[model samples]
Target: MSTSTSSTTPLLSLRGINKSFGAVHVLKGVDLDVWPGKVTALVGDNGAGKSTLIKGIAGIYSFDSGSYSFEGQQVEVTNPKQANALGIEVVYQDLALCDNLDVVQNLYLGREATSGVILDETTMERKATETLKGLSVRTLKSVRMKVSSLSGGQRQTVAIARAVLWNSKLVILDEPTAALGVAQTEQVLQLVRRLADAGLAVILISHNMNDVIRVADNVAALYLGQMAAQVPSESLSHGQIVELITAGRSGDLGLKAPDKEVVA
Candidate 1:
């Protein structure tokens, strides 16, 4: 793991964030901080509100109550366009790349440049090449390779490259290495670390403990709709994080222990 210094002020911050759908509360008083130039791993078990929280951040769902701040200013993000306007981009688990398009086409799917009613292919290809090179990507043999011919890791790289092409300040990756092989997983993890090192705030959501410990500077564990703990990765061991995810409390690091019921 490379040691990269984080900014003193968080690029994104949430306080007492709560969300609900009808009567079911999905997120409760969750607090999180994401600093620039560092990776914060969002880890939890199944149905631990990880998806809800990330959706709220991505503006796919609105929080019922809480303070949402970015770059030291309070803001309201209730839609995807608003989130994009604020320089927040999310690369969802599905990747959403087109199998029929090549790398350049996929990278500029919706936001292609044009000049006088004609597409600027040269500009698009040049920008795509620059973006991939800026990220130090070297696995792809050619920028014109079709998506159907690319491997899982290469597809992930294209999705990530698309996210950062718009000068985004923060990037949220959802289960990026879920079905990748060992070597591919390592490649994706290194790409994630590079995003942060390039001065972009990153929120990595994953269920894998080893991946969390390997590249995350901090770990934020969610347990049953509540934030169990958000601490430095080096401060907690693998067992402690597992306990927090499973039990919502690990010694004194998480929620306070429930009071014992009297036997009267």
Candidate 2:
């Protein structure tokens, strides 16, 4: 789970990112860095601003203030299309697969290839097969199988494959293993690791500490609306990560405590 070298610039970097909804502040000067060929797990309790920060990264929501830099260049991503153009993709928790459609159909749902006036079924199927094979996915029996019939892990696999099919560089996953059995969870976690191994910068959003410890190269903990800490996963124990998530600090590794007022 070693990350890219320190001298390598991050694929995505956000500094002093701030966002709000009307009167409520959702993100407060949060900072995050996503390195190529590594998985950075985004961990936080509910209402910790993880979703807001990710949405900002995906261009689903624009940050009110912050620096959005991709590949060391500053840029403005105002919408999802912009994010996609910059090789960023997000696989939300819902999976977003069309159950009635086959695997190839789901993979090329919106951006289907065409031959003259007809759909290029042959090419699409071939590409789908290749993408799955490239990821070392072996559980799927056929790309023609309907998504509704596939197991939970297989469906997740399809979603992940679809994300990378567009040549995405940064892939963000939200609760990918939620509601899955132990075996299925392991399957998904392995796929997640493979993504980073293939030189893609991956952002994994999950509450499961074990999964984070198992696959993440770096752990980014969000507390309330602030970034608690971002450190190498191997450097922190499970309990230390839990403390950062819950209290915004694990000893000196996270946010410092505010000054106490004098009562005298």
Candidate 3:
């Protein structure tokens, strides 16, 4: 696969992020960044606001306050299309595919290639084939096979191929390996790392500590809408990360509260 050298800047950044629903706050002053060629894992509990933060980034939900900047410029992303235009793509688990449609069809579903009113079958097929081949994803021979005929892992591959087709700069993947077997989980993890190596920043949210430890360059934990810690993967041990996830704090994690005088 072809690639460019590092450009020396973060592809995306979120600053002082906050989100609230009615009287409850979900994300409290969250700060995060996605550097090109790195996988940044966002870990948290069920209600730690990880999903909410992704929605705000994907434009599914508007933020109550804070900023999102891309390539050093702050812009408003009010809808999915706006986010798409900015080359920010989010791939969730469901593997959203049409069971009846073929791989080429799913790859170019809403935005199919065409010559006037006629579908450009030849062009679309060739491009889809090239994309899969480029990513070293060649588990299937026939692109015309329906989704129902493909295995779970193959279906996930199609979904990700579509994202890469869009030239996405920042891709957010939510529990990509949650439903697959051990082998399939490894398949998706390899794909995730390949995407980052191709220069697209990746944000992976998963409960599997092993997966995070295997692929993530940095880990950020969200505990009850607050950032418990954000540091390199080597800084924390396996048990330490798990402790922060379950109890919101871990003395062994080497994360000490900042010094502040409580009262005079």
Candidate 4:
């Protein structure tokens, strides 16, 4: 739970990012930094602009204004392809796997290896097996099994492994444990920690406070489309995180709190 990135430059930094839909403003001067080898949890209530912020990063929608810097260099990511080209991968809430497809098929769905106009099934299967093995994933019975027969945790693992197999620098997981049971959630959370341990920046978007507190190194709360605060998870209590999510700041944060309120 102790995530210290001292003396290390952030791998991804967003400065004053603004997004709007016609007359509706979604993000307002949002600023955030993601360090390699750490997990930054993005939490917010419904309509707090968490989704909008992530979409902008995912290149689903272009931000009306603001700056995006990856590895301290300014860049424009106009589409998911651009994001992927920059070593950014987003594993959405749905997991987006073809249920009927086997593990190797899902892993190499679109980017399968080919040999003289023929699908290289042997190579793809070997790569899939190696990828899972590299992640230290041992619970899977077989990488050739159809996704439909895998448990929720195994599916999540496969999705994450696929992202990592591409040499991704940053992996954004949206609600990874949302539909999973307790043990399954624990399994996915362990993989999340392993991701950071392997030196990849991880942005975990989840509404579950317990999971966030348990796995996140740093927690960034989004309030009304703005970044309320980004602090070490160990420095915040569950109630304080909820307070920031709901009110943009913790009301009980005496001297540490901002001085916007005057004591009568």
Which model scores highest in TM-score? 1
Ranking by lDDT: 2, 1, 4, 3
Residue-pair clashes, model 3 = 0
Residue-level lDDT of model 4, residues 1-264, one tens digit each, is 645443279898999999989898989999989989999999999998988988888889898888999988999998999899989998999999999999999999899999999999999989899989878899899988999999999999999988988989999999999999999998899899888887899999999999999999889999888888988899999999999898888864411454587789
User: TM-score, each model?
Assistant: 0.98, 0.98, 0.92, 0.93
Computed on alpha carbons, the lDDT of every model, listed in order, comes to: 0.94, 0.94, 0.86, 0.89
Q: What value of lDDT does candidate 4 attain over all alpha carbons?
A: 0.89
Q: lDDT for model 2, please.
A: 0.94
lDDT of 2 by residue, 137-169 (tens): 999999999999999999999999999999999
The TM-score that candidate 2 achieves is: 0.98
Candidate 3 segments whose C-alpha is farther than 4 A from its true place: 1-8, 252-264
Model 4 RMSD in Å is 2.8
Candidate 2: which stretches are off by over 4 Å? 2-7
Candidate 2 vs candidate 3, TM-score winner: 2
Best-first order by TM-score: 1, 2, 4, 3
> Residue 140's C-alpha lDDT in candidate 4?
90
The residue-level lDDT of candidate 3 at 80 comes to: 90
Which regions of candidate 1 fall more than 4 Å away from where they truly are? none
Candidate 3 vs 4: which has more lDDT: 4
Q: Candidate 4: list runs displaced more than 4 Å.
A: 2-7, 252-264
